[model samples]
Target: MRNFDQWLSEMRPSINEYNFYVNFEKVYANVDSMKVELNILNSLVGSKDIEQDFREILKRYPETLRCIPTLLAVRQHEIYAQDEEGAFLYDFSRMNYSVEQYIAFMKKTGLLSLIGEHIINNLVDYCLGIETGLDSNARKNRGGHQMERLVEVYLKKAGLEYYKEMYLTQIEQTWGVDLSAISAEGTSTKRWDFVVKTDQRIYLIETNFYSSGGSKLNETSRSYKMIAEEAKSIPDTEFVWITDGGGWKSARRNLHETFDVLEHLYNIADLERGIFNSIFV
Candidate 1:
């Protein structure tokens, strides 16, 4: 058995890959989808008569209205507000309110000033920048995927055929593992990150990476520990957890508890040492 200190020492400080920060491909796709709408709204830029110009543009291109909230960095089409004047829900989807009401909304919300005063030159370019800013919000999800992608690389390198996001039903039908202990009488919607078949055995894998400490790490540690025990009950099947990141340092006690019972748990450092070769062999 590995000592707690020794196991903690093996935890990685970071598993951040190059694409961990911003998924530019997804950002580009988002921006591309809104390109036509943003271009149509460009008519409002630097318009001395923003109200008249905006109404004219909307008459020709109703879809442009849906792109308005995003100019202010909002993801939704409907904006709600209660001001000194009155309460209103501005639906930019197709201008649910009158043009005058929208003009009032624009002026009150400072969007008219933003465009009429030439604060920005082109809505197309400006929205591209806004879309970039909005894409930053996806960093958390992208960061979470780094560990999965990293594990996939090693899995591929080990030459093991695998399926991603394998469900309990699929595993039962394929291997006949009797997952009743893990699922609710074999009717649960449980799924695993990856499932591999090799040399008369099936491996169930779970993966996660954390860069910051949170209560989630503790919960994840406990939960995966339960999964590890459940997998142990089925013959010819094993559970493998691939987790890393300095965040575990703060939750070492919880991680240590899981580590004590789950020897198949590994980190980035373990992969670097060719652990997959031994395990997958």
Candidate 2:
């Protein structure tokens, strides 16, 4: 047996190797995809007469209305709002009401002022800023990918063939095993991060790396422990959990509980020491 305390101490604080946090390539592609409608709205950038200019733009290109929601960093086509005046649900996908209602929405939401007062010099650059703000929300997801990507490289180096983002149905169907215990319902779904096959057994893998302390670490540790416990009843399967991060320092009790039950729990330090060759062999 190895020392869990020592293992936790050796875990990496982060796996970020790249300086560019937000994926600008994805952002630029998004902007390019909606260029036509964006240029239509660009007509309002420096309008001395915004009201009529906006009305004329809408008259010529009604589809531009769909892009309005995203201008405010909103992803949905319908936005619900209420004021002392009354309640309203503005649908940008199409004209849900008279031009007057949308104009009211624009005025109420400050879109009109933002355009009329020349707050934005160019629509593309302004939306790039909004898209950048929106992409920041993807940082957590990107952090998850960083760990998975790093693990994949090591797995490849170890010469193990694997499946990525595998679900219960596919694994059970392919291997002739059962995993209804983990599914919320028989017909519903659960996915493992990766699955590796060795000559002796199949390894169901879960991987994550947290950079900071959080309430989620405790819950995650507990949940994966339950998964490991349930997975034992399924034959020819081994549950391997690979998790790291200084965040686990704050959630030590639950992590310790998991560490006690799980023989295959490992951190990046283990990977660096070429633990995969031992486990898969």
Candidate 3:
């Protein structure tokens, strides 16, 4: 099998396309939901007592009630079930909350806000073709430069490796760890991302660039759990997951839970400290 670097080089385009498609889906869904919610909120604006109640709730329980799933559900039910809207209005009236606080929370955490900002900036130039656009057939190619620039900026600031050797060299020099890129058959996998050997243990490190979604986390967690269990059978081997890229921002909440279950989960920042400190310190 090809090593991870080669596989990544060959697969980066497809992975990026997947990311954009997923993001677009999320944006469209959120926008549709927002429109419905806005209409419901508009109707409630006429009720002075209920409006005052909502404002109080927003002030008090911003984190719990203002979460994305709850907000989405509230809006969905308000728009679809008119009967429920009366109950919702009654509930809000008792609580003392306001619509403004809800909107503020949406603006704070929603990825749509970021997407909207990007669209506003590039709408006339890229979307409308009012300005020059680069020639590219791939979806990733269209916005790939921006993504690469972001990645490069993050790598420079965070000491993440775009190329594999930088990571391996850091490990070797800082902690006396030697790294090799290996394959599944126990052969030297040149395409492998990282294989590090310390005085007492050998570790197989896989650097995933994919976004961390709930489903993705479940699958990765299962794989890592198996690897961890399997590594125990070997007596002296270890596994480490080194994930990076902006994709992590979206599913960080779910990923955090997944990491908690795994014995060895490290991001680029953790990797920079040298594997010795990462695992031990």
Under the 3 Å rule for N, CA and C atoms, how many clashes does model 1 have?
A: 0
- The local distance difference test score of model 2 is 0.85
Predictions in order: lDDT = 0.84, 0.85, 0.43
- The C-alpha stretches of model 1 lying farther than 4 A from their native spots are 1-4, 32-40, 84-86
Question: Where's the lowest-lDDT run of ten residues in candidate 1?
Answer: 15-24
RMSD of 3: 18.9
Deviating ranges (above 4 Å) for candidate 2: 17-20, 178-190, 214-216, 222-236
lDDT of 1 by residue, 201-237 (tens): 8888998888789999999999989988887888888
Predicted structure with the largest TM-score when compared to the true one: 1
Report clashes for each candidate as comma-separated counts: 0, 0, 16
TM-score of each: 0.88, 0.85, 0.32
Span of ten consecutive residues with least summed lDDT in model 3: 126-135
Q: Candidate 3 residues 1-281, lDDT tens each?
A: 22333322322222343344334444444445334333333322333454354355456543323223333333222222123223322133222335664444444444234323333332112221211121122345435344334334444554433333334345445555434322233443233245555556756556565533346755765666555555555545566665555445454554555465557765444444554344521
lDDT of 3 at 169: 45
Report residue 204 deviation for candidate 1 (angstroms): 1.2
Q: Which prediction has more favorable TM-score, 1 or 2?
A: 1
